[model samples]
Target: MNRVKYIFFGILTFSVINLYPQINRVMGMGGLTYAITDIDYSLTPYNFGGNPAWIVVDEEETLLDITPNFQNSWGNYRRMYDSEGAINYGTAFKGVKRLSSKGTFVGFTSYNYEVVRNLYRTLRKDAYTGEAYYMIDTTQGDFRYTGPVVGLTYSWEMFNDLFIGVSGTYQITDGLKQVYTNAQSIFREVSINAGLAYRLSNDFVIASNIKYSDFQETIEAKDVNLLDVEVYNYKGDTYFIGKRGSSVTQKLNKKRFEYRGQVYVKPTEKLSFAIIGNIIPEIAKVLVPQNSLIDVEEVYTDFYTIDIQAKSQYQLFENTLLGLKVGYNNKNGWSNNSKKNLLMWDWNISDFYYGLGTSYKFDFIPMLIGAEFEISSIKADSSKYIDSRFTNVSASNNRIRVGAEYELFEDHFIRAGFNYGNDEVDVLYGGSDVKKLGVSAGFGFRLSSAIYVNANVQYRKVSTEYGGSLSRGGLSSFITLRLNTF
Candidate 1:
């Protein structure tokens, strides 16, 4: 059997936040749910305050998946074992106004998490008499992820019908949790964003935004050969591979830019239509050099590209909105590793996703409810060097959101909501199914005509077959302040 698959997932699982630290990794419901199902609309709201009307909200922001998603990228902030529980936290907020020719806005966000949960890994080893038997589903140690982000943004109208905006940010992470080159590591990256918006006419507007980032990650690998698990033992003597998380595995110093343009038309006072297009540069990925792993000198690079989305939104009524999004994502990737040690294979992948949703505001209490459904197909080509374990992993998802916001007294507002979904994933060696639920509550205050503040708290839980055992969860709380001018 190829050690690539075994070693890859093994080492990769321990890799810090971003490498496995993904956009929605906590939603991986034991092959039952896809990471995409566990998504957050905002990172966290500590920098800005509440609003009677919040355009974004999600449950996973405070519910750590305890999977590689958060642990692989920014696992440093994790304060406890996530296997015993989880805490995913994040928020986003900004306020702006056209002050004659100059516009300015300030906002802040943060996302931190910690989760400890159980995993049922079906183990397989060649047995005597050429017989293969299943090993006991083992319970490994717990894991975690935590971090914070802060930023400021500004915009200026350069000319008639033209506008420019820029954003600067500072990020801090703790407990970086990825590993590459046989080492324990950490992950942290700082990035920038800018965008442009133009008015075609009184009834039309178009806009696009781009971002740049560079971060480091370090990885540390333990000598499993001496651990309690008999299955992982090798030679008696073991040495550390040094910390690779700072620059190995998932810790990528990326310089990618994603641009999107949208044109909105207001043909009449009551009806509005909008369409959007996206341009995503190729993804940049670099692997750990063998020289850093086992004293072997080698390095490699992998580049991939995709133009993943096309979407549209329409407003039938002033209080009702409809949205449709489709993605022709090509998770296709390339590889260029020349080292003849153990990490060389065809790194090709392609995946696609289709989604649709609608949101409405109820008149009674101004409640807002949105629901989305999606289907995905992510797969790889089988080759001698390719590990087909994950070939059959695929999934479908159905999401429903129910939320209500009401003005408590004038500009002050309160909100509460819930979310539910299911996902399935192909983990190469094995796959599982998952289901989850989220609960959230938030309040906002309009301090003045141009300033506002908001606070929110949320909790989430996931359930799946971990030897048919039930798992615990975590919670998150956030606050944000926003300033707007006219």
Candidate 2:
């Protein structure tokens, strides 16, 4: 009985968030530097916002970066609500500048366009909410989304051995479906973050950060064929009410808050370590339009998440470096019916990760090599109120990666990398028995004394088995140009 429950839980609560590839030159080397604690050699200045106060202490040079990227994927082995394929393309502009001896500023803006082909019954981007308050229909079609995002961050050394920073971002998107029951969607998001860091001594520093975000998505479906459109409003995993209409509208609103703290220690010039912890709380509400001015609340959900991680870096030798990382995360949430004032469903999930990596620079030649290994474990539990249905599940995954770079001559470099992973449970859709493989190659060129260019291309394949074997593959590429000014 427990095994059956676990299978169901895995099928219902699996999802993944797709993120754009980084535009840094180090990305060609399989991103090994991303896990290291050295701020001066990090991949991107934008990532410093994770500990916003680090902006003031970062010693990277001032520069402007322009990046253009594209990615595409297609497959048949997917979740019930997933799209058959997708294409994404975008461009971004980012900059970092030093205002004075004590102040630093960062800014970024980007535009993205996406096409989701042959999406299934779900009409919402997030279809796995335990509340089961989403809308669906029998028809499937392509959906298009386009949007622009803008953000700004500033850090200042407020006092001796103390630093403060603040950041804000805003994004808006518009989406439309191509076929009958042409659904239209509008999404808006806003976020703000603030943090402070203090140096307790020459060897230790502590930092804390707080963040808040608000999001809203409105979807409306309308048909011009003069035919009644059938829609299902789900109240649970297997139960839903049916309605026939020419048009319908719904809205989802979410608010979230996060608190984070970190401590960094440098006992010696050769070794450094950091420990970080985060807590997040979030709430979401589902509403249906009842009239021109009134809306009815259907479901309300409360969620909380906790995460902790430790990272360490050691210069094993004059030209060799070793890095280690360990992390754990837990998330739990519950949903209730607003009208009936009764609990509908609840779920909990936990994850653990371990990673080790090393890099070496050759003394006789202009070459660098790196290798990494990682392991992950996941567990989940869920319960539904109406049927008293409960489920529990667990899975594990392992990965290996290797990369190398060679300086062909002064100001020019070539890089290549390979990675493979095996999963007892698929990370994207929760299907069991999965294998993933990827290969990437890139080049970096110094166009002039103050300008540089970097480009990379990568291809990946995923194979999964449910009742039968299926495979999916995709290509992703990016080009970045940097202009440095003193």
Candidate 3:
């Protein structure tokens, strides 16, 4: 029971705000980064905001995107406990104008709102037989959290071949409730992006980009009722446990940098070569107090990470594409040692990842098929555990996806896909890994020449290799509408 309380607070302190655009079409392709050709919304070539130099517009245009998503899952505890669910709605606005022959300007903004809720259950395991059993469902009250995000970005060409961009974002979360606890959090971020692209000739183009960002987050929990829990261990002091309301505050700050270089060479009409390389580095610090009553009891954590990747793509027959990617990622962290906390530990983790992707379009019919496969090998320095218990620590996993689209009429399309993957960690009870399988179906319609809408639904399941699984999987659905103005 004490462990559960500690884990709950840890989640509230470490949960990071996600700001990436959730484009359903892109995710249907297994979230393949190396095979991405649509430069307008590709994060691999630039950063979170976008690449200023890559914006392409024939005339002045305004683009709008709206998406709503729903997700629910079970288990995967320590963060999202049992019966977890979320609903999110997001909208983005962008305006691009071709100012002159050598200059272009682009501006964009987006907002997202989400409602998250979950339930917790208690369980017991027999020591002699080592059999697990459930005691009570939702021993604690239902947990809920709500948040909203706002962001703006601007990019303009500074010179003949140089471009500059900047972005800012702010997020606030309210109504955060966990068991008998209530909390709130705030997040802020600012980033700058710069790039240079030069066209050597009509057949070739080379570009490079650099991005940097600073981020900060704060979480506060007040009037937390800790008296009813056994974790408080108040030394049998009834007055302090019953009358006092516990409070906690935590803060986190991070700085990040990224560099990307790309080259595209079109030697002939049916053949082309594309290559990209990326380097990313990040540093972060966290401050958390041991308890609310002690003013001087606190701990500090420092973390650092570095990542590098290279990808290449080849286009053949003008309608078929092949891509390959290789990458390495590493992270190291340390925290101040405290005697009161037995979980104080440091860690070093590293991994290697690789992937392959291919796609083809039939010339005789209006049909397209695409597939992607990826694998990751990870290693971590041994200890009780690092990050979270759900983390696989040292493991290898593989993922694969295939999707197809068919245009039955002039402006209507149908799409379908399937995916399978292995989880990062094995099942706790069975000691065997869990695998996931999913199927998706969707359609698209072109209302007009400038407006398009897409809707997709995915059904997924997670099951253990052996018997006696701990949880069920999730179901997700999303819809997107895009508007273009001339």
Candidate 4:
């Protein structure tokens, strides 16, 4: 009995944190293979997986295997379960280059600027409110924690044809929520990302990547008012039923890292197609069973996914181009995550994006170059998030971004862009729109004929309601260097 109370206390009071059953239909869905970026080689913080499956041996070499079970419903269904974190982001870099007649090539290509923040801050309000609550569960002692976080990302070319990258991040001192438990506590951990690509043809490429995320936070027991009374003649049941207040703290952590990929091909000189997909096998679902349970084991899962996209670009005239892209993703369903099917009849939520863009140049306008106009729709299903509050809603994200670059000097340049995505999701409470803006500038200096240096700076803003109450704004920054621009 003491042990169960202690565990519940650890879960509820442990951290300033932060999912779930569904049969994993995809293999290699829960490994750290995709979240990392090859923005630099100096540091490797994350990876996306496509590697041969192998059990990552722990201290005792206990072969950790997660299975799916639908039995959470009065033991009717049982599925493999475990905590799985999956993430991925990618962009196409198209550049027009200068190739010489002497069998020499020299040109520039601009890929999506993946500026993993060296570090960023997250300021929040309302982290400490509501409950007259005493500890129901965790390891980190009492007192809600809240503060800003610092994140870093590194990406660089690997094996000439591959790009490997990782992100390393930690928070200052937050009583944020825990990963596996609801308790409050201080949290710290690292995640990994990795990627690989092969140029299939002059106008085609295929890549696979993975990412990792692991966080741990501790919680402590809280004291609350109890019913002071004696029942009937049973003297043995005379113990205090008030809330528990213990100094002992408990730890709740999460290890979510998985891999996925994208494949691109050009069917014509101006037409391209791609397929993108990722996996999230198991999301942690905690049950106290009774007030006596101490700690619970995290369940992992297996799942699969499929995504396809098509894009086309056309030269509208000299220095002007137009592009269009469309896509669709489908999940066949997994056993553990099959509960997602519960809401399948209610709404469909799959990660998908489609858009059209146009760019024009003004080479004749004294440094007043061209600009680009783009509009896109990003749609998703909340059930896959493995949560109740996030379920029941078919969310659609709509966005628009306009970008321009101007040369300050012959070699130095300045650029800026603004984008916005409104949450078209159906939720129980609020939140539907988000405004965003991006500003960036870069410098290019030539030290010699063969070596050059490029440095860039970018700032991004996200404006919306902070908690349920206060309205706030979030910002992110990035810096990059291209030592050898081919």
Give the best candidate by TM-score: 2
| Candidate 1 local lDDT, 137-242, one digit each (tens) | 1234333445666666656566776767667677755552221112233556676777666777867666666766665543334333433221221110121122
**lDDT for every model?**
0.41, 0.77, 0.52, 0.33
Compose the digit string of candidate 2's lDDT tens values, residues 41-63. Answer: 44222242276776867635688
Candidate 4: RMSD to truth: 16.1
Candidate 3, which ten residues in sequence have the lowest lDDT sum?
Answer: 124-133
Using lDDT as the measure, what is the rank order of every candidate, best first?
Answer: 2, 3, 1, 4
| Regions of model 3 farther than 4 Å from truth | 1-22, 28-44, 47-50, 56-61, 75-83, 89-111, 119-139, 188-212, 224-247, 257-283, 288-297, 338-343, 384-394, 423-432, 465-467
Instruction: Write the number of the candidate with greater lDDT, choosing between 1 and 2.
Output: 2
Q: Which stretches of candidate 2 lie over 4 Å from their true place?
A: 1-23, 34-49, 129-131, 225-228, 386-388
Candidate 2, residue 74: Cα displacement in angstroms equals: 0.9
For each predicted model, how many residue pairs clash, with residues at least 3 apart or on different chains?
Answer: 91, 0, 0, 114
Query: Candidate 1 or 3, higher lDDT?
Result: 3
Instruction: Output the better candidate (1/3) by TM-score.
Output: 3
Candidate RMSDs in Å, in order, are: 11.0, 3.0, 7.7, 16.1
lDDT of 3 by residue, 191-295 (tens): 776666665665666777787887765555454445322212111101111122355455555677877677666677544455565566665444445555533
User: Which scores better on lDDT, 3 or 4?
Assistant: 3
Q: Which candidate, 2 or 3, would have the higher lDDT against the true structure?
A: 2
Best by lDDT: 2
Name the runs in model 1 displaced over 4 angstroms: 1-100, 105-150, 172-186, 208-210, 219-255, 279-299, 310-313, 317-321, 341-343, 347-390, 407-409, 424-430, 445-453, 466-472, 481-486
